[model samples]
Target: MSEPTPDAPSGPPFAVPITVRGYETDTQGHLNQSVYLQYAEHARWSLLKAAGIGQQDLVGHGVGPVALETTIRYLKELRAGDETVMSCRFRWGTGKTFRIEQTLTTADGTVAAEVAAVGGLLDLTERRLIKDPGGFLRELAADPGLLDR
Candidate 1:
C-alpha cells in the first residue's frame, strides 16, 4: 500500500471560494460547522471534474463509491465576508476504499477546516463492495505523484 502522505500544497490546496450566506451561520455569527462539510463536498466534485471522472461515468460503468465515512477537523471559525479556498487530493486505498484529504483555508492563509473521506468501490448493480475499475483506480493511484510531500 502506498502510504498516505502529508502534503503541504503550493497553492490553495483545493482552493475554491465560498460565500457564506446569513442562513448558514449560527447565533455565534460564524459559519455553522456543518456548512464547512458542505463546502468540502463541492470541492470534491470539482476534483472529480478536474480528474475527468463524473458521476455519470461511475453509474454507467455499474460501479460507484459511496462516502462511507468522514473526519472533519475545524481549525478556525469563519464568518460572513470571509472567502475560503479549499484544496482536496484524491487517495487510493490498499484496503477497500478511496479517500480524499482536503483542507480549507482563509484567503490570506489559515486552515479553516480539514476533511478526510473514505469511500469504497461498489458494484452498484449488485449493491455491494467490489474491485474498482482498473483503469480508473490506476488514475487515482497516479494522483499522489502530483502531491508535494
Candidate 2:
C-alpha cells in the first residue's frame, strides 16, 4: 500500500453500506445466518480498502489475516431490500491477535446483528502467527491512523 493521501478518511469504525439481497435470505424471509458473517467480512475488507491496503500488499509481505473465532448476536430480522450499514473496528492488544467488532444496522437505526471476532496476521512461509499483527497491519496501511481507535 502507498502513503495516505491528504483526503484519506481518518480513524476507526469504518463503514460500508449494503442492501440485503433476496438471494441472501432464508426460507423464513430473514437474512441467512451465515450471511451475517459474510457481511462482517465485507466490512473488514472495505476497511482495509479505505486504508489503502490490498490483498496483494499483505500477500507480497508474506502475511495474511486469519479469523480464529467469531461470535454473532442476532438482534433483529433483516429482510430483502432492507438497507443496512456494516461497520468494522479493530481493537489491538500487545500480542499477535486483535479483536474485531462489527455491527449490522438497518437504515432506520435498528441493529440487526453484532459480530465479534478474534483475528491475527499469519506468516505465509512459516504458517505461524505474526509476532505483532497490529504492527504489521500498520506497516501495510496507507492511513495507519485508520487502524487506531
Candidate 3:
C-alpha cells in the first residue's frame, strides 16, 4: 500500500489493492494500455460496493451507471508482480452526471496512471439516460462531506 500523496483529495477514498499480472502486460513488459481502463473500472465498482451499492442493487432499482466519457493518462510503467493501489473519488457534475477520478499507484506511492470519467444513471427499463437520477444516485453523487462519515 502507498501513502496518500500531498495533493490527494480530501475525505476517505475507496481503495483496492492489485498486483499486475503477466497477461496484463505487453511486449515491453509494461501494463497494457487497456488494462489501465480496467483498473479504473474496478476501482469505480469497488467504490460503489464500499458505499453499499452493488450490481444487484442497481438492477433492483432498475438503474445502472453508464459512463459517457473517460480520459486516462499514463505516468509510469507497471510490470508483472508489481503491487499497486487503485483509488477512486466521486464528485458531482451537471444534473445527473458525476465525475469519477481514479489513480493507479505503485506500492511506494508513484503514480502509474490517472483516469477521469463522466457518467450518469441509466434507467434500465426505459433504456434511456436519466436526466434527474433518483435519491440513491443523487446521494452517491453528493460530496462525501455531506455524507455520514
- What C-alpha RMSD separates each model from the true structure? 4.0, 5.0, 6.3
TM-score-better candidate, 1 vs 3:
3
Clashes of each: 5, 0, 0
Name the better of 2 and 3 by lDDT: 2
Clashing pairs in 1: 13-87, 14-86, 14-87, 15-86, 16-86
Clashing pairs in 3: none
Candidate 3, superposed: residue stretches over 4 Å from native: 1-10, 132-134, 138-149
Which candidate order results from sorting by TM-score in descending order? Answer: 2, 3, 1
Question: How much lDDT does each candidate structure score?
Answer: 0.69, 0.86, 0.75
- In the range 4-48, model 2's lDDT, one tens digit per residue, is 332333464778999999999999999999999999999999888
**Total clashing pairs in model 2:** 0
Worst 10 residues of 2 by lDDT: 1-10
Question: What is candidate 1's lDDT per residue for 1-149, written digit by digit as tens?
Answer: 34443343334354467777788999999989888788988887666655566778667777776788999998898888788887777655445666678888888889888899887778877888765332354455334333322
- Score candidate 3 by TM-score against the native: 0.82
Answer with 1 or 2, whichever has the higher lDDT: 2
Angstrom error of the Cα, residue 127, model 2: value is 0.7
Candidate with maximal TM-score: 2
